[model samples]
Each structure stands twice: as structure tokens, then as C-alpha cells.
Target: MQSPIHETTELEELEEFVINFRMRRLKLGFSQTDVGSVVGKLYGKALSQPTISRFEVLNLSYYKMCYLQTLLQKWLEETEDSLKHSSDLTGFYPFTTYQPIERGRLSQRSFTRAFMHNPKPTSEEFGYLAERLGMEKKVVRIWFYNR
Candidate 1:
């Protein structure tokens, strides 16, 4: 549970909290995008679905995880309270009306080959791969980033 940059009880607790958080979120019938829509309103900083997903999986930096935990902790409390007080929780939460972004499927074969050849592809290399894979350069970049 101890990340290299942050080896502390706090990190361990956060790691545990993240696992529980995801469970509770699913139990509450909330998707990552659903949480993302309202988490910002819980505090001031709005997080995207991808960001929330990263936080849940501990893919973020220790510092970023710490910050997001504070926000999500508050959100968890509010969401629970809403569930307790209302059968229709949507009335209590200000879930956004915006549509979720369409997720792009990557070409696994090409990406795997690219990764094996160069784990950290340069900007130009990323552009080339993106063109060959028919995906946005940013998507290709994020794929590598997540890896």
C-alpha cells in the first residue's frame, strides 16, 4: 500500500479508502461519470470521469490522490445522506445534464507493437502511431501515460 514517493500511514489509509469508495459508489448505483459530475460541486474543483477513474485505481500521484480523496470523501458523505433521506436521490444531487464523452477503442495489436518497440514514444513517434492507428494523438498519449 505504500507508494514510493509517499510511504506513510496516510497513503495506506488512502489506498484502503479508494477500494471501499469504489465499492460504495457502485452500491449506490453511481458511475464514475455520475460522481465526476457532482464531485466538483461538493467542493470547488470539478474532476472528469477519467480523473476519478485514475483516483479509484491509485494511478495518480500521491499528492494528487491526497487532494482528490478529500473531495471524494466529502462527496461520499453527501451522497449517503441523500440516499438516506430521499428515495429519489436525483432530487438531492445536482447531477449535470451534459453527455459523457465517447470513449475511443484503441487498436491493441498496433499499440502493443508500438509499446514493445518503444515504451516511451516521443512526440513525433506518437503522432506517427496515432496516424497509423487512426486515433487522436492525445488518446495515444494517454494510453501510454496510463501504462
Candidate 2:
């Protein structure tokens, strides 16, 4: 029950968020990978560098875009506050250089095994699978939901 005009306005806002997110991330001297890592630390789920890049390019769904915008906005505020209080920025540089673990796509067999084991995993199960698969817990949860 949404109008076309409302949808258009929402798209414009999302575009603006993406532009601002990219600019602020660059100004902070944090790469996409760094932002992803920091986000992972802040939130329990970790996003990958490619996912961060996709966000900057506005390639994700609106729901995901909004979620990431909230996360990045909080991160940006914290980073700015840290810079204001610290005499040097050296402490922040380590995050920029740190590399997150690489995770490839989950195999069909593994997906089936997980889905067959429990269609609706509890939070603890989701966390365990996410850690074992090197994927975000949300991703694991969604996969189960969709299956």
C-alpha cells in the first residue's frame, strides 16, 4: 500500500545515504574492509569488503541499505569522537590495515545439511553456524528462513 511517489523519494534518500557513506568512509581513511571489520566488532555479524563496496555503489536492497546506513552512521560518530579526544590517529590506523577472514560461498551440500538439521535454528545455533561458516549470523538465519 505505497505510492510511486513515496517509493521514488525513498530511493533518492537511499542514494544520498550511499554518497555520504562513501565520502565519510574515505575521509576517515578507512577502507571498505576496515569498515566491515569495525562493523563486525560493533555488531555481532561481519560484512565483507565486497558487501561494503556494494553498499557504496547502491547495489543492495532497500532493507539492507537502511540497515547498513544505521550501522555506518554510528561507526562514523564514534570515529569522530575518538579523533577529537585522541592526540594522535595512530591507534585508528591498525583497523585500516587489519584484514578480515575470507569466506567463500557455502556449498549446496552444506546448505542442505544445515537446512535438514534444523529449519529454524535457535539464536545459539545460528551463531554457531555463522562462526563455522565464516558468515554473518543474519545471513545464516535468513538462509534457514528461506529454505
Query: What does candidate 2's lDDT look like per residue over 50-102, in tens digits?
Result: 99999998888889988988888888887788789884544754433232222
TM-score, every prediction: 0.58, 0.58
lDDT of 1 at 82: 77
lDDT, candidate 2, residue 72?
84
Candidate 1's residue-wise lDDT over 1-147, tens digit each? 657666776778999999999999888777787687577665767688899999989999989998888888888998788778886665675343322232223367677888999999999999888766535689989989998
In terms of lDDT, which candidate is strongest? 1
Worst 10 residues of 1 by lDDT: 97-106
Question: lDDT of candidate 1?
Answer: 0.77
For model 2, name the residue pairs that clash.
Answer: none
Error of 1 at 33 (Å): 0.9
Estimate candidate 2's RMSD in Å. Answer: 11.1
